[model samples]
Target: MAGETDPLATEQPPLSAGDLPAELPGELIAPEVAALEVPPELVAQSLGEYVRAWGARIRGGDPGVLPVILGLAIIAVLFQIVSPGNVFLSAGNLVNLFQQSAVFMVLGMAEIFVLLLGEIDLSTGYVAGLAGVIGVQLVQPVTTNFPWWVAIMAALLACAVIGAAQGTLVARLRLPSFVVTLGGNLIFNGVMLWALLFGPFSGYPTLGDQTNPHVLYQLMWGTIDPLIGWIILTALVVVVGGSFWLRDSRRRRSGLVAPPVSLTALKIVLIAVVGAAVVAICNINRAHFGTIEGVPWVILIVIGLLGLWTVLLQRTRFGRYIYAIGGNPEASRRAGINLVRVRTLAFVLCSMTAGLAGLLYVANQGGASNNFPGGQYVLYAVAAAVIGGTSLFGGRGRVLHGVLGGLVIGGINNGLYLLGLDVKVQFVVTGFVLLAAVTIDALSRRGASVGSVAHI
Candidate 1:
C-alpha cells in the first residue's frame, strides 16, 4: 500500500500545455539527453567527412569512357582544323594515313623492346636500310642469286647479329646504351653506303630491268574494298568486345574495380564508329583516272607488328622483366631476372624490326641508291617513337603510341604539303612536336608522382 500510494497522488495535478516542455510528454529522458549531448564540433566534422568522401568518389579512376572518347574527338577536331574542307577525313586519305603510319608502327613496336628495358638503340634505321640493301643484293644476279625469302632471312640474321653485338657491348661490358648505340648508328650507316655504291639493288623481282614504271608504281599503290573493310571491322569488333568483356569479368572476380558497364559499351561504340569510318573513307576512290582498294600491305604489316608487340609486352615474362628492368634495374637483378639476355634480345628484335622496315622502304621506293641516308631516317624513327608516347627515358610507352605519333608527324607533313609549305618548315615543325611530346611526358610523370588528375 505504501509503494502504490504515490501513483494516484502524482496524477492529482493536471499540467497545462504551456507548462509542458516542447518534447513529447512522458518520453524517456535518456534519449533526450543523448540527443542534446551531440557536440556542434561533431556536426561540423561530419559535414567535412561527407564532402571529402564525395570528392574522392568523383576523382577516382572510374571516369567512365569519357577520357578516351574525348581524346579521340579532340584528335578529330585538330585534324579538321589543320586541313580545311575536311580533306584529311577523306577515305583515300585515311588509307594513306594508315600506309604512312605503318613504318612508324613497326619501328615503334621494335623500339618498345629496348624502351621497356630503359635502353636506347640508335642504329635501327641504318640497320634496316642495310638489311634491305643486302637482301636485295643477295637476290640480284650480280650478288648471290638467292631466293627472295632467303634474302629476307639473310637480312634479318645480319640485323640480329649486329643487334646482338651491340647488346653485348652494352650489357656484358657495362657500357652506356646511348654510347654503344650511337656508335652502332655510324657503323651501320657506313655499311649501308658501302653496299649501295657498287650496283642498283632492285627490290622488285618481277618488274625486270626497269628503274620505275608508271603502271607498276600504280600497282604499288593501295586500295580499300568496302566489303572487306566491313568484314575486318566486324572481326575487330568481336575481338575487341570479347577482350573487354573478359578483362572486366576477371577484374570484378578478382575484387578489383572494373570499368562501369556504360563505359565499356561506350568504348565499343566509339571503336566501331571509327573503324567503320576508316573503311568507308578508304573505299572512296581518290584517283580520278584509276581506282585504289583496301589498306596497303604496309598497313597490314604495321598492324600485325603492333598486335604482336602488344602481346609481347603485355603477356610475356620476358616483357615483364624488360619493364621491371626499365622501372628499376637493381630490383630486377635482385629478383633473379636476366638483364643481359633481356637486353640482348631487345636489341636483336629492335634491329630485326628495323630491317623489316628497311625492306618496306625499298619496296616502296623501287630501288636502293648510294645517296640514301639511313642516319636521317633513324632520327625520324626515334622522333616518331618519342612523339607517339614512348618515353625517351623508357618504362612508359606502347606500340600504338608510336603509330599515333607517326601519324601525327605524317599528318603534319601531309598537311604542310597540301598548304605548299617548305620542307625545312616541315622539319622544324616536326622537331617542335617531338620536343613538346617529350616535355609533356616528363611533366605528366612528375604530376603523376604528385597525385594530380591533370598529369596525363
Candidate 2:
C-alpha cells in the first residue's frame, strides 16, 4: 500500500518525449562549442571515402595539383604522337627537360613564398643575375680564389640583404609591393650589368673560361651512378612510406582524424613507382656510344628542394600564418599575427631563394650573361607557379606546384623545339596555357565561396 500510494501523489510518472528534460542525466552530451574542423577528405576512414571526400572538396574549390599533372601527361603523349622524330619522350630530351626546368622551378618556388603572402617580387630575375655575378667574381682565381661554397654564401647573403631592404620598404613604409619591386628590378638590372663589366676578372663578354668557374656548372649536368641512383630511390621510398605511417599514427593517437591507412599506403606505393620510373628513365643508355648515365644532379637538387619546401609550407606555423594573412589580412592582424615580421621574412626568403636559383641558372648555362632577360625570367617563374595550379590572388599555392608547373613549361618549350616550332608559336601556346590556368583558378575560387555560403 505504501509503495503504490505515491503513484497518484508524489511518485514521478513515466516521462514522455514531450515531458523529457532538456538534457538527460545518462545521455551523451553534445558539445556546446565545436572544435576547428578539417576537410573530410583529409581524414577519410577508407579509400573510397577518401576519394569521395576529395571529389567533394574539388567541387568546393580545392582542385589541387591533379589537373596540372594530368595536363602534363597529356602534353607528353600528344607531343610524342605528333613529333616526326618522336623526340618528346627521348632519353636525351627528357634529361634536357630536367636541366631546363631547374632554374624555372627554383625561381617559381622563390615567387611562391611571396605569392602565398599575396605579394610580388618583380626584382627576383635581376636579383638572381646580380647574385650570380657576385658569386662568379668571388670564385675566380684572378679575383679572390675563394672556394665555391664561400662564394655561394656571399651571393645568397647579398640577395637576402636586397630582399630585406625591399621588404622593409613594403612592410614598414606600407608601400605597394609592385612599386617597390619594380624599382628594385631596374636598380638590380643596372647593378648586374655593372658587375659583369667591372667585377673582378672581366675582359670578354663572358666572365669565366670554357670551363667557367671550374666544374660548378657541371653539377647540374653530372649524373649519379646507376646503382647509386637506384639505391637513393629505394631509400627515399622507405623513408617516405615510413614517415607517412608514423605521422598518421601519431595523429590518430592524439585523437585527431587521420587519413585512412590504405590511402597512405597507396600514396607511398605511387611515390615509389614514380621515383622508380624516373630513375629507370635516367639510367637509359642514351649516349651515342652506349655510355651509361643515371639521374642528373639537377633532378636531385629539384627533388630535394621540393621535399624541403613542401615540409616547410605544410608543417610549419610560419607557413600557416602566410596562408592566413593571404586569406584575410585584417583577420590575421586581429588575431595578433606579426604582419610586418612575417611579410619581411617572406620577402627575404623569396630573395634568398632567387639567389639560389641564380646559382642554378649559372650552373646550367655555364655563366650568367649581361643579357639574362631578368624580366622575362620573372614572367616565366610566375607562369610556372600559376600553371602548376597555384593561384595568383594568393592564399592558395605550394612549392610543389611550382615544380610541377616548371615541368609543364619546360615540356612545352622542349616539345616545341623537338617539333621544330619557332619561339613565336611557343610564346603563343604558353600564353594561352597561363590564361587557362588563371581562369580555372578564378572559377574554382568562386565556386568554393558559393559553396561555403550555401553551407552557412
Residue pairs in collision within model 2: none
- Give me the runs in candidate 1 sitting further than 4 Å from their true place: 1-86, 141-145, 197-226, 250-264, 452-456
Best-fitting candidate, scored by lDDT: 2
- What RMSD, rounded to one decimal, does every model reach? 19.1, 11.8
Query: Per-residue lDDT tens digits of candidate 1, residues 93-136?
Result: 66666665555656666776787677888888788889877766
Best by TM-score: 2
Q: Name the 10 consecutive residues with the lowest summed lDDT in model 2.
A: 27-36
